[model samples]
Target: MVLNLGGFKFEWKQTSEIAIETDFGINSQERIANFEALLSAKLGSQSINLNGQTLPFAQDGQEALKPLYALAELRQSLPLVTGLGKYLGRFAIEKISENRSVFAPNGAFFTQTFSLTLRRDYDADIA
Candidate 1:
């Protein structure tokens, strides 16, 4: 649906996945939880496709790419939100990948795909 990174916003493509991860450790004596940190978090890639050469569609591609580039440039932790302003967590952009295909007559790309990965940043007091 909608995704925002700092000041950029876009309507995401139809296919996307979100994942969260956690961990637990065992002790030799009691086989009980032995780790001070019991929870972990990770985010799945957000993918989008830009296609067509029409007025709005071509412009949408540029708009989507702008935020992705901004995330990569900004190394500091930033807020990530999804589902109509529900706060997911603070995170840093870990990686980004782009695929381009089907060049136009003028050598402009007619189809583009992008994938973005974000990693959670634990608070100082929590971790």
Candidate 2:
């Protein structure tokens, strides 16, 4: 399915790939992890805030990333990616039974197709 708001669009499918996957289907932490990883890889060699602490990278990049970091955090807490069109007036997402997704925003068409099965991180568990 595809829903287009403004110019941005989101198309969901039923693929066996999930770069941003979550078992709870509602846990916010997984989203946070995804965002943090993206920022780290995409914004490498730059200084930005992660969670609370400031992260200074070892590369050059756009100055606006600082703000993007904040936005990412906020979005992590209360995700609006699905409805970005409503707030920013441009975006879309098709709710399907797909484990994978392709996010094309602005001039960057990011595609992440992951073939993964579910396995609880028992090692990270702490009681």
Cα lDDT tens digits for candidate 2, 1-127: 1322222223343122233332332222336436622222221111111111111121212231334334333322121223234431211122211122343454332332222122222222222
- Colliding residue pairs in candidate 2: 17-100, 17-114, 45-58, 45-59, 46-57
Candidate 2 local Cα displacement, residue 73, angstroms: 6.5
In model 1, how large is the Cα lDDT of residue 24? 30
| Cα lDDT tens digits for candidate 1, 1-127 | 4656565554555224444543233323334466354332432233222222222245564345765677679786677766488876676777767766777776677666665666666661144
Please estimate how well model 1 matches the true structure, expressed as its whole-model Cα lDDT.
0.55
TM-score of 1: 0.61
Model 1 ranges off by over 4 Å: 20-58, 61-63, 124-127
Q: What are the models' TM-scores? A: 0.61, 0.19
Model 2 TM-score relative to the real fold: 0.19
Question: Number of clashes in model 1?
Answer: 0
Model 2 residue 85 lDDT? 40
Clashing pairs in 1: none
Model 2 residue 113 lDDT? 27
lDDT of 1 at 74: 72
